[model samples]
Target: MIYFFKLIRWKNLLLIILAQLLIKYALLEPLKVDYGLDTALTPLGFILLVIATISIAAAGYIINDIEDVEADTINKPDSVIIGKQISEKSATNLFIILNIIGVVSGFLISRAVDKSAFFVLFIITSGLLYLYSTYLKRITLIGNIVIAGLVSLSILLVGIFDLIPVISDSNKSSQLFFLSLIKDYAIFAFMINLLRELVKDIEDTDGDYKMNIQSMPILLGRSRATKLVFILSLIPLMIIVFYLSNNLYKQPMAIGYVLILIVAPMIYSTIKLFNATHKKDYKHISTVLKLIMLTGVLSLLLFQFILLK
Candidate 1:
């Protein structure tokens, strides 16, 4: 059981579940009192939606590990599980099984919501995750963007299911409000994950290079890769600053919290990325980026504060 969870990067899986729950409960539920959760889908419907999300994510991890088996032997030999504890055949089977479940559940739920077209979303996500492992993982730049966009989709999925069903001609205000917030978080996730993906490329440069994967690090060199990540970090940093400057300024405490907890750490990440050379250095950079991502999600708690007033 422990090996299974660890294999799927279970902590990260749980974090996804928690993040979705927080959005559904902490954000959407409160808004419901003012508007509506806006879904004709029952509790069972939302449960299936969460299932679809987790199933696709789990399948992604399985395939990612399958592709990483060779690279992991070189980069982190101790972590490789494909042919050791779990056979390649077994992992592939699980990948197929989970994807089927995710897609089927999505198909049913899409039909429930009068959007039969949504089944394509599940299929596309599954295919993209597979392609990301098989082909894109070897390509430069494009691979990182694909994975980051999928990460954003995890957050956006909730909004899509919850809001899309009820978007009539009448309540444009509610529909637009939810869509805007979802887009904001999607962009935020994209920036943070894109940075993390590049940092991982730098960290895993040794294995990736041996695999002849044309990652930014292997193509551009370590210092240049770090510089690229540093440069890209500015997009999100500026976004948060503008976010703070415009939205949170009225609440000094909120502004201070955003600046200190979120903004400062990103600035610090950029500075640290410059001097990082060893794998361990890039490992720290990866961890710092993960922290920033978590803080960005947790910042949603502040919305409660604003709503209370």
Candidate 2:
């Protein structure tokens, strides 16, 4: 059981659950009455959505692990689970089972909202993750972008189901306004996850090279790739600054929260990235970036106070 949880990356799955919960309760629900908005999913339906999303995500992790078993053996042999704790056949079975649950649950929820078309999103996401693991991960940068985009989509999925389905003419603008808010956070998640993926690419260069994987670090060389990633890391800082100046400048509390929790840590990660040369250094930077992503999502809670004010 313990190994199964680790194989599915329960921690990351929990983060997905947390972000979706915040989107529903802390962000979207608060705006429903004031903006004359209606949500398509009830609380129970929303729980099903969370299950669908995380089930597919866990399946992704399992399949990725199965395909990367050789690379994992070279990279982190001690942490490898597919062959050590669970048989490859068992892992594959789990992958198929989870995907079935995810897509079926997605179908049920979409039909419940009378937007059966939304079911395609789950199928596409599942297929993309499978492609990413089997083939795309071998291509430089493509896999990183694909994974990052999916991370962003997880955040946007809530808005699509909850808000878009209920957009009447009277509430179209308000619906879009709140949907745009979710989109902004999704973009933030994209930028952070993209960088983190590249950092992991750098960290696992040795194993990737051994496996003939054409990752960014293997293609450009770790030093050059790290330099590129360091430059890219500046983007979120710039975006946050622009966001603050345009929107949050008047809200001192919001500004303080962004600076202290998100901005400061991002700067620290950037500086660390600049000097990061060893695998351990990249690992540390990756951990910092994960925290930044968490803080960025938690900022959604602040919207409750901001909206009320």
Candidate 3:
């Protein structure tokens, strides 16, 4: 059971759940936003959505682990679970079960919301995850971008499911406004995840090279890949700074939160990446980036107060 949880990356799944809840309850509900006003999901419905999302994500993790067994044995032998603690057959079964549950729940939710077409999002996401594990992940840069897009999609899914169906002519502008804000956050998630994925690629270069995987670090030398990741890391920093200056300049509390929790840590991560040489160093930077992502998600809470003011 413990190995199963580790294999599924329960921490990441929990983060997904938290980010979705914050967007739904803390950010949208507090604004009395028109986007979800008409077709607002009840608490039960929202729970179902979260369950479906996490299940799909879990299945993705399982399949990724199954496919990466050789890579994992080299990268982190002690942590490998697919062949050590669980058989490949059992892991594959879990993957199929989770995908079934996710798709079925998504279908039911689409019907409940009267937007049956929305079910395709889940189907597409599932297929992409499979392809990513089996093939896309070996293509230089493409795999990182694909995975990051999926991460961003998870954030944007809240807006799509909650806002799109409720939108009418009367609330179209307001709906788009709120959705645009969600899109910004989703973009943020994408950029941050992209950098982190590259960092992980660098960290696991030895294993990836041994397996003939063509990750960024393998295609471009380690030094070049590290330079690229460091440069890319600056993007989110500039974006947040611009956002703070333009919108949150007068909101001391909000600015302080962004600076301390978001901006400062990002700066630190960027600096650390500049000198990162060992696997442990890249691993630490990855952990820092994950924390930054969590802080970015939690920053949605400040909007409750900001909006009320």
Candidate 4:
């Protein structure tokens, strides 16, 4: 059971669940958004949506591990599980089972919301995850962008399933407004995930190189790749600062929270990236980036206070 959790990357899976829950309860509900008030999915339906999402994500992790066993053996022998703990055959079975559940559940949710077309999102996500594990991940920047896009999609799925299906002519304007807000956060997730992916590529250059994977670090060399990642990190920091100044300046508590928790840590991570030479340094930077992502997600809780004032 422990090995199974590790294989599926349970920490990441939990983050996915938390992000969805926050979007549903913290952001949408408190705002009194009317889009899904009448025809929206029930609580049970929402749980199914979360399950479908994490199932696909878990399958992705499993397939990724299966494909990267050789690389993992070289990169972090201590963390390798495919061959040591769980047989490769069992891992593959789990992957297949998860993908089935994810797609089927997504189909059910789309029907529940009376937007069957939304089912394609799950299909595309599953396909991309499979391709990412097999081929795209070895290609320069494509893998990073694909994975980041999927992360953004997970965030946006809340808006689509909750708001779009219930949108009427009367509520269209307000519905879109909240959706645009969600999109902003999704873009933030994409940028942060992209930077983190690059950092991981640089950190895992040894294993990737041995596997003949043409990642950014292997192609451009670690020094140049690290510099590129550092430069890219500034994009999110600048965006967040601008958002705080323009949108949250009137709220001192929100501004302070954004600065101390999100912006400040991002700045620190960027600086750390500039000086990161050793794998451990890059690993530390990655951990910092993950924390920034968490803090950014948690910032949704601040919206209730903002809306009240």
Candidate 5:
């Protein structure tokens, strides 16, 4: 049971759920807006959306593991499960089941919102994850972009599910406000995941090289790839700094938090990245990126105090 959960990366799934919950309660629910949702249906609606996101994400993990078995044998041998602890056949079964559950949940939610047409988002999301694992991931940098796009979609999924259906003459302003907020979150997700995915490519360059996976690291060489990742990692930091300079410079605590916890560490990571040549070095750098991602997401909380003032 533990292995199964680990295999599907339940931790990350939980993070996705938490992100959605924070968006709802911390950000949206408090706003003086209709939100296009009945207060009565809010909890159950959120739960269904959370379940659907987890199912699709879990299915993605299963197929990625199945497709990357050989690559994992090189990069993460001890953790590969498709043909060792669980058979490939069983993994495929789990994939189908997860997709079914995800799509069904979306279907039900669509009906509840009177937006049955939006169910296609679920179907398209599942199919794309499958395609990513099976083919797109083997192509090269394009795979990273695809997965990053999907991560952004997860943030937007909540808006599509809960806020869109209620848009009308009266609630249009409220709906637009939520949509803008969701868009900000989605862009944050994209930037963080794009950075992480590039780091992962560098981390797995060895396995990817042997498997002819055509990853950025394999095509660009580790030295260049690390440089590229370091360059890319600075993007969000610079953006945030500028954004805060204009937006949060008036707020001492929020600006301090970004400078110390977010910006400073990222600068250190870039320096560490340049000296990192060994696989273990790349591994640590990858972990640093993961922490940065968490810090980025948690920055949403700063909005609370910012909004209060």
Candidate 6:
């Protein structure tokens, strides 16, 4: 059971659940009350949506682990689970089961909202995750970008389901306004996750090389890859500064929160990435990026402060 939880990356699945809950409750709920913004998901339906997203994500993790067993044995042999703790066959079965649950639940939620077309997103995401594990993981940069876009998509899914379905000609402008806010957060997720993915590539370069998997770190050398990632890391800082100047300048509390929690750590991470050499250093930077992603998501809670007042 413990190994199973680790295989599915329960902690990451929890983060996904938390982010979705925050989107519906902290962000959209406040706006709905203060601004009369319409939302589509009922509590029960929202639960289904979370289930669908995490199930697919869990499946993705499992399949990725299965495919990377050789790499894992080299990269972090002690942490490898697919062959020792969990059989490859069992892991494959679990992946299939999770994908079914995810896609079917997605179909149900899409139908519930009278948008059956939205069901395709789940199928496509599941397919992409599978392809990424098997084929795309071998490519340079493409795999990282694909995974990062999927991370952003998870956040944007909330806006597509909750905000878009309810948009009317009367409230189209206001609906789009809130959706744009969600989109901004999605973009933030993309940037942070992209950096993290690149950092992971650098960290796993030895293992990836053994498997003939090419990455930025492998192709350009770790020093060059780290330099590129360090440059990319600054993009989020610029976006946050622009966002603060244009949107949150008046809200001192909000600006302070972004600076202290999100922006400061990002700066620290970039500096660390610049100096990073050992695998442990890259791992630490990856962890910091994950925390920044969490803080960025949690920033949605501040919307209650900004919108209600």
Global lDDT of each candidate: 0.83, 0.94, 0.91, 0.92, 0.81, 0.93
Question: RMSDs, each prediction?
Answer: 1.5, 0.7, 1.4, 1.3, 2.1, 0.8
lDDT of 6 by residue, 1-309 (tens): 999999999988888888899999998887775687899999989999999999999999999999999999999999999989999999999999999999999999999888999999999999999999999989998999999999899999999999889999888888899899889988988999999999999999999999999999999999999999999899888988898989888999999999999989999999999899999999999999999988988888898878777
Off by over 4 Å in 2: none
Please provide, for model 3 over 5-25, each residue's C-alpha lDDT reduced to its tens digit, 9 standing for 90 to 100: 998999999999999999999
Q: Write the per-residue lDDT of candidate 2 for residues 11-55, one digit (tens) a residue.
A: 888888889999999998887788787899998899889999999
Give me the overall lDDT of model 5. 0.81
Model 3 lowest lDDT segment of ten: 32-41
Ranking of predictions according to TM-score: 2, 6, 4, 3, 1, 5
lDDT of 1 at 51: 89
Which candidate, 1 or 3, would have the higher TM-score against the true structure?
3
Tens digit of lDDT per residue, candidate 5, span 16-133? 8778887777776765443443222378877888888889999999999999999999999988888988989988999999999999998887787778898898998898998988
Residue-wise C-alpha lDDT for candidate 1, range 121-162, written one tens digit per residue: 889999999999999989999999999999899888878887
Q: List ranges where model 1 is wrong by over 4 Å.
A: 35-37
Model 5 stretches astray by more than 4 angstroms: 33-41
Candidate 6, pairs of clashing residues: none
| Candidate 4 collision pairs | none
Q: Point out the higher-scoring one by lDDT: 1 or 4.
A: 4
TM-score of each: 0.95, 0.99, 0.97, 0.98, 0.93, 0.99
Candidate 4 C-alpha lDDT tens digits along 1-47: 99999999999899889999998889888777433333376788899
